[model samples]
Target: MSWAAGEFSQEEDRYSEVLRRQWGSPTLRGIYRDAYGADYPEEADPFGFVTRTDLARITELVAVEPGELLADLGCGRGGPGLVVARERGAVLRGVDVVEAAVTEARELARELGGEAEFAVGSFEQTGLADHSCAAVMSVDAFWMVWDKPGSLAELGRILRPGGRFVFTTWEPSYLDHRELLTEAGFEVLVHEHTPDWLHRQLAVYRGILGHRRRLADEMGQTAAATLIAEARETRSVLATTPRVLIAASTPA
Candidate 1:
C-alpha cells in the first residue's frame, strides 16, 4: 500500500506494522542478507547504500565524542547507530516506532557486541530524560512522521546544552519534501548540497532494484517478488520527496 493512504493519526502505527511484518519474515531476511550483506559489516556497512554517505556528512557536522550519550531517532535496524557507537565509543540509544526493527537492532547489537541500546517508541514521545543526550541523529525516516515540528522540539528537549542534532532527508532538488526542523526550534549548522547528490541517490535506488532481481534469481520467485514490491514502494515515495541533510544544535 502507498504511504499516503494512511491517516495521520495512524501513520506511525501503519509504518511500524508494515516494517515489523516485513522484517519478521524469513524470506525478507534472506533477501536483505543477499542484497545488503550481513547487517552492515564494519567494512561493507550495508546501510551505506541507504544512508551512509549522508550519515558521514551529518557526523562531521555534529562531532560526537567518545563516552558521550547519543540518541538515534528513527534508527532503522540500528545501522547508523552502530556506526557511531563503534566509531566513537559513545553510549548510543536507538529508538524507532517499529517493534520488529527495534528487536532486530537489539539482537544485532548483542551479536556485534556493540554498546548500544534499542527501544521501540516514537521520536516525538520517547520517554528519554530531558537534556540527556549529547547528540541526536536520524536517517531518511522523518517523512513518515506526522509532526516534524513536535519531533524537533522533542529532540531539543532531550539534548544537553550545546548538543547537536543531525539527520538526512530526501533533497528538495529531487523531491518535494517539507522542512520541519527550522519550524520547531533548531538553528541550522550546515545546509549545502553535495555534488551530484541526486544522481547518487538515484543510483542507490537502482542498486536496490538490481539486488532485488539478483536475490529473486537465487532464492526463488516469492522472495524476489516481496523485495521487488518493497523496493518499488520505497522508490515511488523517494522519487517525489525532497531530500536534505540537516544539522542543528540545541541552544545552551
Candidate 2:
C-alpha cells in the first residue's frame, strides 16, 4: 500500500522529537508509575487510553495465546505491548517510527523480562511479512497513523486470516467513521464509545498541569503552555471527544 504524504506523514519527524523528549522524561515516568501502576517503560500519553484496566480489556479482546505473534503498531517505549505480552503469554513485536522509541522499547523488554522485539518503522510501512502475525494492536496509538486507508491496508496485509485487530483510540465522531474499517474489509466485532474515558483522561492532563507545572515547563514552555491551554479549554479539545475501546477481526 502506498500513501501520498499528507499532514501526519509530513509531521513524522516532528512527532518523534516531541515524544522523544516527553516520553523519555524521568518525571513523567515516575508520575505514570505512581499514579497508574505502570511499572514499565512508557511515554505517558496525557491524551491516550492506556490504563491497566484498558490494557487488560484489550488483552482479552485480542484473544492472543501463548507463542502467538502479537504485533504492536506504534509501540512507543513498549509499556502497552509488554503488558499484553506478559498477560497473554504471546511473543510481542513492536514498531515505531521514532528511533528513540524503538531503542527504549528494546531496553524495556530486557528490563521487564518479556519476550518481544522492536524496530524503527511506521504504521503505513511496517516492515513485517505478509500474514506474519496472529494479532495486531495499538494502545492509544492508532490516531497517529496519518494515512488511514493505506495503513489499514498494510495492517490487513500483515495479519493472517482470522487474526484479530484491537485498538484504544479516540475519534471525534466515533460512529460516523465506521466506513473506514468497512472499506478496509475488517469485520467489526466491537465498536463501543467511551466518553467517560476521555473525560478522565482530560482530568488527568489538567491535574498534571496543575501539580507538575515545573515539570511541564521543563518539557517545553510553548508546548506545555499550549497543552495546558487545551486542557483548560477542553470543551472542544477533549470535553466532548469520544474515545473508543473498539475491537475487530479479519475473516478466516
**TM-score for each candidate, following the candidate numbering:** 0.72, 0.82
Over 4 Å off in model 1, which ranges?
1-14, 21-51, 171-179, 194-197, 200-240
Model 2 clash number: 0
For residues 24-142, what per-residue lDDT tens digits would candidate 1 score against the true structure? Answer: 34443433344433322343133323444555666676677888888888887887777766777788899987777788888778776667898977878977899999898877676
Which 10-residue window in model 2 sums to the lowest lDDT? 1-10
Model 2 spans with C-alpha error above 4 angstroms: 1-14, 24-47, 211-213, 222-226, 229-235
Write the residue-wise lDDT of candidate 2 on 1-86 in tens digits: 01122111223443444566665455654555555544223432332446766776788888988999999998888778887888
Model 1, clash count? 13
